[model samples]
Target: MSIAKTLAALVVVAALAGAGITAPPTATAAEASPPRAQAGEEVFYHVFFRSFRDSDGDRIGDLRGLTERLDYLEDLGITSILLTPLQPSPFYHNYFPTDFETIEPKYGTLDDYFAFVRGAHARGLKVYLDQEIQYVGEGHPWWTRSQGFAGAPFADFLLWRDAARTEAEPFLDRATWPHYDGRQIGIAMIDLNNPRVRDYFTRVLLFWADPHGDGSGRDGVDGYRIDHMMDDLDHKGVATDLFAGFWRPVFEALRARRPDFRILAEQADWGFGEDWLVRGDADLVFAFPLRGALIDLDKDKIVQAVRETEAITQADKGQIVFLENHDTDRFMSLIDDDPARARAAAALSLLLRGEPLLYYGQELGMRGITREDGMSDSNHIPLREAMRWSAELDAPGAAIWYRGDKPWWTEPANRAHDGVSVEEQQGDADSLLAWYRTLLALRQARPELRGGDQRLPCGDASEVLCVLRESGDARSLLLVNLGDAEARPALDATIADDRWIDLIDGGTVDPSTLSLAPMTVRILGTP
Candidate 1:
């Protein structure tokens, strides 16, 4: 939080890079001028509900605990929050819902949920709920009653195989239901082809978007992150191809009420999503190819990836670029505690032309990655560990409730002694968290950085990559030296303006003579 401390951290970074310290002028009036880009490159912070803050000393995160941490999210300049499912379920993760309408008691009552929505809205943070509509837990009434004899009333709710050709038979009456077996789950897939079943989910969505059926306009989420979406919501993996007919109408019906509402799809097979997602009415999908390049530090692939991202990312639809998340390995695993690797990757992720996102503890450089050691969901345990408030593992903010479920191979990316805790980083301006603050603030200050047509000026450089972001009356340059040695990038077109401001390093620069230290990132604006 102090200017002097930040300079000291930057000096430490310089020492780490093995370069001479040439301090840049600290940006004192970054907020003086508003960016030309509308909203100027906003970011989303994804919170794994159970791994986040906990209240009432339960050693488990709840809506109340999350509400208490709104200021922390606000300080990070996050414009949106994406939450995992909060509906009642038998599972610890709450994915397969036993009851779609009720909030989990462990997460708090419905009253707590409304309070959280109001609290987040008051802070100008748009909240998006994550929903898993594909299945219901074994304990769900739909599953319970339907699996019985004597003509189940809600038998049509699920995809069940049967000999009788009755109306209650599943859409895929020929194929049996999927093997409902997984760690912490044994669930039945929903029959999306059933009009009644589709209607049920539609109501569930509407309830969350606008809790009060009345026109009071309160206690609702801004949008939704739909889970495990596919074209064929068929029974037992059979091709029903109901998405176009079933999904389009659902989105259209929702938009008729809330026109500006957004929808994101977890298109696991993202290779085909570039074409498939738009058809399914998804506004955003995960960008996997570019992310792979970033994690490997492959500069050439990253260049091609930027081109590919620009090709698919349109005004109405785009990709959401993220490095660390609950389902995937933490970016810190690749970083291995090196400041250069972290800074370079961050630069590429933040500056690339797409919607940027961050996992909750990614700013503190949290590390973990699930492994394929012939184990199941146990590998995910490391990636979803508790937040590091201080150094002590048993500290108050460390909710180690789920730590008991950790697999044998689970390894913490960082420890309290590693000085990666928020308390430790809060003292140093040059910390990874501080750099994130500067990068996010820079995106807010420079419209071109967020809104411009991006082009890589350096052609096929093995170590250095330069992205030229240009908009009318605003121009900015993002340079990164990903290689071990020093690298200099040049623009194909000459910069008539010689003076520039370093948005991250807080210094002045001349683009023509600029040199990037190893694993360094520079965002320079024309002066």
Candidate 2:
């Protein structure tokens, strides 16, 4: 009846269930029993193609560089690599595609791309290509057709906004809101109403998803990270219909072939809630609402934001956690440079519902703001400030920040003297990086922390924000002191009875009452 007793019962039942489910072999197991993606556990890696250096000192980052980093990625427990577009785009970011079939030569040959995929698969890492279908580069061959692009039902595929109504319609105005890459000569809006265009788009997607070249030439792609999906205009008032139509066949087809294939849609806003599931295509959506609050100065404010996110998004917290991604300003800079607060945010991110994305430098206390250089410039590459790798910079259960060539955007703040490098932080047991890694590991080790029907463990949810995640009998509790000063909050440890173990501090917690340090976060569960 009590929370502890309920949790103990659940654990026993789970053990019985798992006992019947034969355990997979260890790392030394044969190839046939190779590791697989853990359910409810997914990791995404954001790779910038142009920001890498080849062995020859070439300025471009190619598939080979990524291939080489597979172990590094695997070490971090990343399950998938979300590559920025590899298509032949005129710019370095690869978002503006000139050729869908070709890998950017600057990033190496198509063969290199193939090798990267093969390498990733070898490491059991699924690869997801960034799909930016809303727009194409100004120089795409389709735009060059002189017949005004009349290809059967695809004639209206490329949209041509009414020149007269351009003043009233904001999305149609091209000259004013140019693309991020300067080379964009004009706007790249396509006519989603055209079925032919839709079919063509589907064909392209299917082509990539087919590993046998049965549809196009390439084999199946494991997953697709749809880009700027929210940017397209839905003249028919059924935006979900259009995007879903474009994807339903592809997703169904891929699942029919590779059942484990994933689709992570970029639903930056909250509109795609039901459609994401109805379409049965996307496995994940960017939790932007959560990102907007994670950086707020007030911990209470952040917790309140989390509660709202749980309510508004209608997504199972276990499936839709927040992330500070490549598109946004770094979390550190956005949070006013408070390292402790940053750790608190990190704790919430790793412990809360949904999956968490560790943007490259995020582990190293990196900081930077949104700038005109574009998202890639602001948070991805330019923020790659030098990371400390000295023995002193290590963190328990954490990997070194920069195991390879320094990224192009190395920060001056992370220089040797500041003692912020991975090496320096590694030495300080309470370093932000260490705190993040420890809390993350703790969250992963406990099933209750993964999110389920949540219960506020503390008597007062607002002041001390105590949350309990439970599935059947498995339970994990997260407690944060939202108040500025030390506050001891009382809680029903058992929901029915008061007893808990403060996992973070390694102390037995009597559910009836507990004192939380200012902005403190603790994970509690039976070992």
Candidate 3:
């Protein structure tokens, strides 16, 4: 081996030996298990905990705040709330955990979480927690004890290397490891192959899934959104087969307890595929590539991607389709803040055939985006900024970014706070927020639109991408002009009944042909 490679191997081996990890952790099918992770056709609202609401007046959002908003969410037509990580962490974005069992104090206590859960359940809303089991933050007891101590119980918990950079080569900072999403975000990848770690995490999940230890199964979460759900270790041998064996057993155990619990995976790759089902047993995976198409406001890309997603997904498994989530920039930033484009994007995402997930403040056109000039880690904070409740600076419930008391984020490039609020949009019939309410309310009233097969009606045309969602005898046609000017697409008059009905505003459409306004979407149904 070259001197550098040889030295590297030695350094890793030394660290491992000193950490008391003689070998990799052992695994078995018996080690992993779940609550039957059930994801029925329901609309989801994704909320970043700290940014959503602050009931304590501490400038940070808490469970009390979340609980108080359940009525609002229910009214908004969302059936569930997909929360970002709430585990204790040193960072503002709590993807990495210092402790999994405890809730971040800023968010509230365990009692608060359970209360929020019970409250959501009362409102007939399901809640799913974001579970990122792959990474650990700086001060986690496991990391400190395993790396520095001689007899570390968690020595097998982390991925380490060997060779010649001294004994401390492998147990370095995130910049040196950069194991997550190909970014050095101050986190270290766990050695997921270790069955002991798997068992430990399973216990953690089970604890949350059934926090009350009661047989009722109502106090815990509906399921989990698994972060960075991967198949195996990249460069390592033997451990590459860990995912199938590890996740299956875990899921089996969970289902043994609660049959209806839902588990969704944020798989590494996002396209037409069912690999996550057979390999990892994840019930649903985020359809990222399709989401990419919607963000561009491209008619063809979005239409084709939706049709492809529906075709590829199996009956038992599904793809969670979304235009904006916590990880990506707000849809407002992507669509150039045009109200028309926002309306078009909302219709494309929420109306299409998939489990729709709407980010909090998405209805009010909440906007935030990271700049290219900023450091990579610093960029996501923009997208995760406070949920703007009102444009009024002194409003009692107005949100402030939690990075600092008063930071540089106070002045954002997008300036998302202007005129975007529940107060402003509540009564405005033509507002963007009003548009979301209309779309979600439509989903609630129409069973066909909720869980139906999607079809592209205007195959012969490219400028206007028309989609037809049908279930039983009920059908809805979504027409959008993807250009600056009007485009008329000729269709069989028989596609609709003698009279056409627009679901958004109860307007009428010509049965023989459709003329679309610029950057507009029309929902045509038989009246």
Local distance difference test, each candidate: 0.70, 0.56, 0.70
Q: Which stretches of candidate 2 lie over 4 Å from their true place?
A: 1-33, 52-56, 147-156, 161-172, 175-184, 213-220, 231-241, 268-281, 297-308, 311-319, 372-429, 459-462, 493-499, 502-507, 511-513
Candidate 3 per-residue lDDT, tens place, 1-527, comes to 11122223232323223222121111122123222213557788999888788786777878898888888898888888899999887667787788776778778865577678777776677889999877687677777776755457776676655322112212223234332134443456677778888887776676567543343355667788887666764343524565676677777767766788778888766545477765788788887878888888776677677767777678888877787887788888777788898888888888887788988888888777764543444556667766777666435554564444433356653354477777777888888877888898887777767887777766555477777778888888888887778887546555744566888677787734667778878887765
Q: Put down candidate 1 lDDT per residue, 212-319, tens digits, no spaces.
A: 433222556767888877776542454366667667777776676666667877785656257546678787777788888888887888887878776866676767
- The residue ranges of model 3 lying beyond 4 angstroms of the native Cα positions read 1-38, 162-186, 234-239, 373-376, 399-407, 413-417, 493-499
Model 2, span 1-527: residue lDDT tens: 21122223232222223222111111222233235455466656665545432423443556676677677666555566777787876554677576665567656654566667666766777677989776566666555451243453422445544432221111333432333333434335555556666655654565456433333212245778777554235342423455555566656765665566667777645542445544445767776666666656355555566666556444431344554665666677766677667767777777777666676657666665554454222234334332233333222222222334433323333334455555567557777766766766666567666545666555444466666788777777777776778786556534526346767777786644657677776667754
TM per model?
0.85, 0.76, 0.85
User: Candidate 3 — number of clashing residue pairs?
Assistant: 32
Please count the clashing residue pairs in each candidate, in the order shown.
Answer: 2, 21, 32
Candidate 1, overall lDDT?
0.70
Candidate 2: Cα lDDT at 326: 59
